[model samples]
Target: MSSSSLEYKLIKENNSTQGISIEGWKIVTKKLPILNSQEIEKVQKEILVPLPEMFFGNNSLSVSNDDYGVLFEFSPIDALKLVDSTKEGGEKVKVAYSEEWTLKSSKNHEHIKDVIKPYDWTYSTLYSGTLKIASKGQKFEKTTERIDIEKLKIPEPILFYDEIMLFEDELADNGTAVLSAKVRVMESGFFILQRFFLRVDDVLFKMNETRVYHEFGTKSLLKEYSSREEHYFKIKAQIPVYKGDDISQLTNPDWVSSKLTNSEELILENLNLLGGNYSKI
Candidate 1:
């Protein structure tokens, strides 16, 4: 209608990536469409990620450690089995993706990498979601160490991928008990670093670990991820922030903390994980 108004509209369109910003960052979320055969093939070649299974299963039990005030419950619906590298057609690997989880994108978003790797050359897929718990769940003691990599026998992961899982059942005896962030295997499954921040009840802790897949036991270093990973959970939520260009129904970190509640004292407690719990020498 007016000369100045029309000019502004054109400028906005040209700088499309400028997008809508929240906290000085663009946060755009777009709904995805179903994939045809060709599209599915493209996805497979890009990141032959294994089909992710439900996080919590029907047999979820509840347990707690009275001594440590810690708890454990919630059984995973289906364990994410290793990737099937054998391809008869040489086109696709064996993995199962439910129709619902098959398609979604977070393009033009800062919180999560949106683009598929190798094929896209732009972004990465970092998923975030919640694990629903029932009120009628059983309760017991966390008699054993919840995470004992040594206890369980693990087959060397043929797939090149990593996972970072964190849990904080409750703090101050009142908070959302949650298990968040277990990533599915991507096609470019090269070995790398993995870390997790775990909190059972009032206890807050951190874990830094790695599993290197030395190709053929002596593969050149050039073909792998960093042997040592220098990383902390960069995002405050450590879970998905279901605010912008994504739709996996993840927890939002609109506030300073998204651990269900924002408390200054609890934040200090987590410092223990970083050796902040120590006193000056």
Candidate 2:
């Protein structure tokens, strides 16, 4: 593995945190059970939108470079904050059963009202990751650089991999909404994806994905954000007739992703890991 620049060892602690430490980079992941009532209360106060039904408040995954003093983290709370809280934009998607859920929530979840506010019920967010720079002069800047999918396609041994679900909601049995993160470390570098999947039974299916890719020993990393969506009937028609009987495919992110169109895409940033000292490629 050293030949591929991935001389790393597996890291495990307390059965809940695990990852890999390689050369100059360290990747860590944490997964915990659903938040308790008390923990949910605290999060509700901190975030503007209504908390999802199955909030894993303590779940997170992060990548850090000690030499570069760069840390990027993904968590449920921080991602939800990027939702359309104002609702004035008129782009928010409303679940087909919003009215029914609203009525039931008003009667059964009295405490939720204290923090509930108008927001995108779908919980779509463009958050790539939370980046913290402990080193001076290092920062992310606008760039036209993009991730080379062709490079990623090359066969390579995966050194480490993990996926965690941060949160999910049933939308009062009308549909499904979920947020999750997954990461894989290969010989050259690594890739991370934070995805939001939404399916409104008869309304639509949408997916928002934030992808980050970095090559080992490189001075920069590329972050790409993409949004894909399709109307309920449109995507439904694309499902293979032989497998249409498996309704679960409708909620599968990968399936929905392949059927939808790329509505928008952006190279959010090109992070310079060498304190703004890298030569332009």
Candidate 3:
């Protein structure tokens, strides 16, 4: 498909500044899946209503009979399996199996205590923003400014559909599964900066021994501004029909890395270089 056909708008707002941009890019597919119409509809419905709703109101009183909507959503179970190809002519690539799965939220409130107690000294500062998709040929416009995180409350736990699948019949007959969904990006290429900030800090400690920090810090700050990284996250895929092709038979999939070479990094570098402007908490 022509790169011009794929356009996206990205709006990022932090403690510093908010910026929006438009851009064009191509989504080159590798091992694309053949999803049935029903599967596609299921995914769209799940994503659109990531959370369920509950209603609360009085049946009698006219003055205090106010209705309230509450969200109650559960995380879906999904698993992705990578099986080594046994075919003769094909390269040694693994096949992906996606499946519908379930995740049981911990019934034990003590489990939450066990998890959060360790981080008692550490507090969580969540940063969340909306990314809206624009229809093709639609002009870009900024609709909402700042969303108050506190006021924009979720009454129930947040849930996500699983991206991985496993099972035998899922991969039977040369079926392919989706590796990743198309991500909408900013037009001006500033979205990469947003992604970098969101992902890098969370995993910086993992790359510490590799000298990633020193190397990254010393490198021309501006040069790293518009960089993009391809993260290979496993999701639930379909299971092949074969008895031996179950989810447990698969191994970890290799990671894919790509940089947003087309996006500009000058703005990102300036923000990083200018100290004390962007605070963590």
Number of the top TM-score candidate: 2
The predicted structure with the larger TM-score, 1 or 3, is 1
Residue ranges of candidate 2 with Cα displaced over 4 Å: 1-5, 87-91, 94-117, 276-281
- Which candidate has the highest lDDT of all? 2
lDDT of 3 by residue, 1-281 (tens): 12433343333333322222222222111121234456545543533211111101010000000011111111121211111112321221111111110111133333322222211111111111111222221221322222222332334211111121111121111222211221212211211111111121111100000000001122111212122222122212222457344443222222112212233222211112222322321
Model 2: per-residue Cα lDDT over 1-281, one tens digit each: 34555468888987889999986789999999999999988999989888888998899999998777778889888888887777542224434445544554566566433323466666667777788654545667878888888998899988889999888988666578899999999988999988899886666787888889899878887888888777776888887789847777787788888788756665567887766554331
In candidate 3, stretches whose alpha carbon ends up further than 4 angstroms from where it belongs are 1-103, 107-113, 118-234, 238-267, 270-281
lDDT value, candidate 1, whole model: 0.23
Better lDDT candidate (1, 2): 2
Q: Higher-lDDT candidate among 2 and 3?
A: 2
Arrange candidates by lDDT, descending: 2, 1, 3
Candidate 3 local lDDT, residue 252: 23
lDDT of 3 at 110: 38
Worst 10 residues of 3 by lDDT: 205-214
Between 1 and 2, whose TM-score is larger? 2
TM-score of model 2 relative to the true fold? 0.85
